[model samples]
Target: MAAETKQSCYEGSSVSSFQFYLERSGEHEAILRCVRDVLPREFKRTGADKSSLDVLGVGSGGGQVDVQMLTMLQSTNPGVPITADIVEGSSELSDNFRALVEKTPNLEKIPFAWNIMHSGDYEKAVQAKGNMKKFDFIHMIQMIYYVDDLADTIKFYHSLLKSNGRLMIIVEGEKGGWDTLWKTYQKELCVDAITQYRSSGEVIACAKSLGLKYEELPVPNQFDITDCFDPSSQTGERLLNFMTAKDNFYESLTPEIRSGILDLLRHKCSTEKDGRVMFDSKLSCILIHA
Candidate 1:
């Protein structure tokens, strides 16, 4: 078992790597499509008796996507007061989110409470238990894998939802490079205690165990990983580093381990297309009804 503690991109100056990962993986198109496909219906479900709506965004990195979702919510429920609570652990990302909110039209009108803390810490401080009905909409996108207890986190978030509330969680599906990568080398790749390999399949199982009512939507996505094999390519290096959750992955690992990982990533996690290696970046979106 590899035990050397390493810095995650969340705490390091590797936001660029993360950004590269998103770009290569074609995440925005699918995620933005999800926001458009789901949020309007969720907004329509808002209880007529409620004077205002509350939104909780967990692991809201950079806030671009969150802003898009919130904008949709505002458009759907115009004239109604909407409060958005952003929970992000990275100070840099939270700052980015803050700066983004400033420039986004119609967002400044809504009150935003920025809690720059890990979801685990946020959960610890949460005193409210089941049936709180405190939130109308709650979303944890691309961040559930970092939580200590996914089951408990789901339950807690579900409890915070109102009768008509919805909890939307988006994560890597079992059919993605992330799942394949982690299953093959999780112990070696995971540097922090927060790192986990749980996919949407596990999320479904957890929700089932909790007997929570939910719907699953699979978003087909892929990544152009043709550059990952080129050692001299900076973009490829960034994607590889992001994939391994390590900084300077090539220089840091032993040759045998490095070669083995590359082999696994190239063969098992991706497929050769028309002169390009396309990675399966499929994501699963689970909407839990409260």
Candidate 2:
């Protein structure tokens, strides 16, 4: 994973800011590959020489995935021109995307433009920055949960996509590995409930209602920070820094509960037998095409 300037990372100065994500691009690369492989499925061949292939990368955070996707497309076909629109709400992240793509060799040469938009203002934003009709691929990854009106948003994206073009939504599955980690540490962490979109089922149902073809892709992930537990070790320093930055997560609990939870996490992360900290995380990729 490559690092970027601190100011060009995320939208805000939250504890879990975009800077943390920059160092974890290696982990996220697999998800990008999976999405790329699944996204083209929605597009059906209309003709041989000319097929309008437009890609709308919704909620394109950090722009790392966008660069990777474009690189993949260019590698497959150098002369291909993909009408790519990067629709992102975070101005900081959007700027990062622009900088990264401009610096990347093959990615910079690709014939595509990035149109950044705030995640909240979709309608007017699109009107101001994008074109209507159908897109070849519309990707929304780890972003629908932030949307206040999920169905309406999907409908709007549906309108932007052409026939056989796909609207792909990738989210962390409720029953996936994240839940397992939450369950494992819930009691220990003094968290009664976790926050996430309700379920992947609703995404599928919502897509179906829009008369789009649907497919689900399952992806799993985990963190193994064994080397970092030695206190003097620096192997997984990137992951460790991420964990430290998340200390404010304890703010969700009462003082007493927070203390207890912290102690438990410390134990789990630094015991003699299990000197490694592990978390199970999994995501679901839902692809919808008209």
Candidate 3:
């Protein structure tokens, strides 16, 4: 559906609403699995020397995924101290993440330094402080959409990596259902004020163009969106908002546009089996080696 003027839907979204969206859409589970699968390949200890690792978590929301990764890293290198620089914009998310760290016993093993700022802001602050801190591992988990220049941001983060360090990026695959839907309707559905939709395919191409050393891995995932068919369901409506990045997506769209989107979701984006709708919500993990 087309609007006379486009607007950002996420401006009014609350932390709880976003969390609910993640939990209901099966995104949380998929991300956790992706992190687990990708960590061992890069975070494992080498030889007998215990290594002290510095990690930079870009746009690490609420620290759920960060905590998991840190736990894995700590387990991989026992007794090795870890310094985590968590970069996040939202105060609510940062506070929630700190609270989680205080409560979780496993997270206690790793000492953390919370950089309560956006990635760019943190970089600027570090530069101002004349600190040349390099990271052993840096992860940007589905957070590049908020960045102004994805390629430049990638290059800057890559430069922050130490020798043999890994910069892991997790985003939706180009041919996945979310990517297809976002690409098709982005012009009409996305907020004009924000950057258009981005996928792992574009990031990989950027890495190749930059001549960066990288490897791509497919992360199998699916979201059961059967509840989205019910227009009156609040969960369904919120899920739609999350998917389209539009506030009240069902309500905002024109009848024809809404129908078209629904048709695409039913036939192309998802498959119906055993009376349930499952979207091929696969993710891509790009490991850029320094």
Candidate 4:
């Protein structure tokens, strides 16, 4: 099937825009930390110790996640070198990624390489010619939902992993803020995100169907850094507002419905028993070997 141009464009832009959000949430750090915590044990047991450790980050643009991942890797093992092969889909974002990495300390110490591979066409890169081929870990965060064929795409990733290597996918869970907002105003939210709503469950099930043993890591709301929205901060204002705006119920909404969404978020952020805006979310890491 041909790639969804409009959706792909939206995703490319969204991933670029989300670079700022990832930095702000310290989510980049949290994820890398999790990888470090589990990777060594997993690798040692799987006999990846002698093998050169390489990481392939799909949808890795602007090196936002790269900085965090590399920083965490260095802290854990300064002598241990990592080969970070980043496959970014957008040329513009890929350039930005290169610039960002240049400023990170000792990033050069590790082998950080990247290419412009449209995420949807990532299979081509994995199958490309080279000794730096395959990977110990292939990571995708908040990006898999855009693929037209989740099962085929995931299976492809599974095929690229070095023996006992892991294919990790981190997505907003079924009960996440993404889903909660959509559920609250499904009619509005569904307008623009119907595909996302429809495919969220299927992606998880797709992995299970393949017999990919996985771990569902719950990262939860964890966005406890502020109150109200700070327009200057990426996640604080843009993300919060985007979630409220994308409610197809909110977008397709008349002025009245738009106003209702605003009012609800306001109330939820204020008087709700959770004391904080309650948004349910989870992240999963699916491990496999080729």
Candidate 5:
């Protein structure tokens, strides 16, 4: 028998480390706030009294945001049942999500079907089911970066919606500091065909080209990346790996290239405030209506 390789790089310590970074940087909080603010206004209630709302979550990580969205949905449509289809590629994340569900109060009100598979796999499964079901709400949060064809994926998700269904997508903005870093090093780091650094600007263009009806909002965010300047800092190295999705990313580069990148990050990508290096980490919230 052959060895079974891991499908996702988000394993064990890396997951927790990335979560720590997200927490410390307040990225998760900002995104949550943005979602809470927009979801109520953007989510369209179709057949509210006829049937339960079916939701599809692509690459839903760890169920934290999933629970939040579900709570909002339940609040919006009181006494309505919800069926959630959670598609996540990481086993660790899925397990954590299950645990979270167990601990979350009133989560039993919403039934969940967890699919430990990638988005492509979920697509195949849906196709194999002969399109028997359609979703009322669908969300893809910061997960399109791993897809091979972004536009096709978005279109496919849109196709799987019931009337008045809404698809929400979150991604980095073009003018954000992370976007500058990604554009500079994407060619070098993104060797995998499925992996690419994309911004909401590109997504908006794609949606417009497809003639899709959409609304977009900006989620202003920031992160302290000062640790990334210290070459000897383990947290710095881990943060770089998290950002670039490459192992030993900072160490692999030539000293000159590394120095140049560091200088760019310090001067162009980040601003020093109260002795902390704060990066301009803005996110985009895009809602596509079906």
Candidate 6:
């Protein structure tokens, strides 16, 4: 992943990482294929009498991916109407997403509403209102790790879903990469206040503990990390910081720790070919019916 300066990668720092991952890994296509393949059944399960579909997007950054998913839903359902409600904490990101929506050709046709608040805040406000709106579909991608209680959050969202509604969760895969790196050095590297290393495996385990059944698909991913090898590159260091979920990781690193991390990244996690190192950041997506 490429990076701009930020305390943590997940804190709305660089869209470059997302764009790069989508470009190289084709995760967007994989996700879209899953959506296309499953939505037909979900829509049918939702019943033919519904006049419109209520879709909730949690932590939908910049709206690029959410818009595409909405488009897919609209295309799949054809005549069925869609109402999109998005929750995002960053006002700037929400504004940018709104601007994107304004320029999008047919997306203007969908009814869109943005709630500029953190997911927890949104949940609190809605619960305070005492009239929870049930949704036909809800998607929380790459943001589950931010919550305090994973199982509780999952259960809360499940409660808000209609009988046949579907909830989609996308998270880091537990196959390799940081999953391996963190095993040895998480306490040193993951120094953030919220340093939960919850991955798809944890999510699946939590789901089972809650007695919720789900189906999932793996989304294999890779990132060009050749720049990370260049100590003189500012982007390289920033990307390292993001990778570690720590601020100033370069300056804070002792020579021994730095060498250890780099060695692990190169040999234990990443692959080298044609003078470029590719970091495999595999992800997984799961679908559950309420």
lDDT top scorer: 1
Q: Better model by TM-score, 5 or 6?
A: 5
lDDT of each: 0.80, 0.57, 0.77, 0.59, 0.79, 0.74
Question: Residue 181's C-alpha lDDT in candidate 5?
Answer: 82
TM-score of each: 0.92, 0.70, 0.90, 0.71, 0.92, 0.87
Q: In candidate 5, which residue ranges exceed 4 Å CA deviation?
A: 1-6, 44-50
lDDT of 5 by residue, 114-172 (tens): 88877877788888988556899898887877776888889899998888888898888
List clashing residue pairs in candidate 2. Answer: 89-118, 89-119, 134-161, 134-162, 135-161, 135-162
Which residue pairs of candidate 4 clash? Answer: 62-97, 176-280, 188-247, 188-248, 188-249, 189-247, 189-248, 189-249, 247-250
Q: Residue-wise lDDT of candidate 2 within 1-290, one digit each (tens)?
A: 11111222234663234465434423486576675675333232421244335677877877777777666555544466666777665566677778888888866545555555555465666668766546767788766755656688788887776655667787766554433334455554322112233346668778778776777888665555454445455544444444333334434447575455345444532334365555444567887756
lDDT of 1: 0.80
Question: Which stretches in model 3 have alpha-carbon errors above 4 Å?
Answer: 1-13, 45-51
Angstrom error of the Cα, residue 290, model 4: value is: 5.2
**Candidate 1 C-alpha lDDT tens digits along 19-124:** 6666677787888887788778778777466789999998888887899988888888778899999888777777888999999998889999887778877777
Model 6: per-residue Cα lDDT over 117-190, one tens digit each: 77777788988999999899999877776676888889888888987788999877886675777666877865
The top-ranked prediction according to TM-score is 5
Candidate 3 — which pairs collide?
A: none
> Model 2's lDDT to the true fold?
0.57
Q: What tens digits encode model 4's per-residue C-alpha lDDT throughout 1-290?
A: 01122233325556544554564455666556666676656555534354356778877655666677657655555466678888666666677778887888888776766666666555754457444377777877666655667788888878778876777776655655455555677766545423444224656688789887666655534454243334256445555544543313323558776666555555443234455543333444444445
Better of 1 and 2 by TM-score: 1
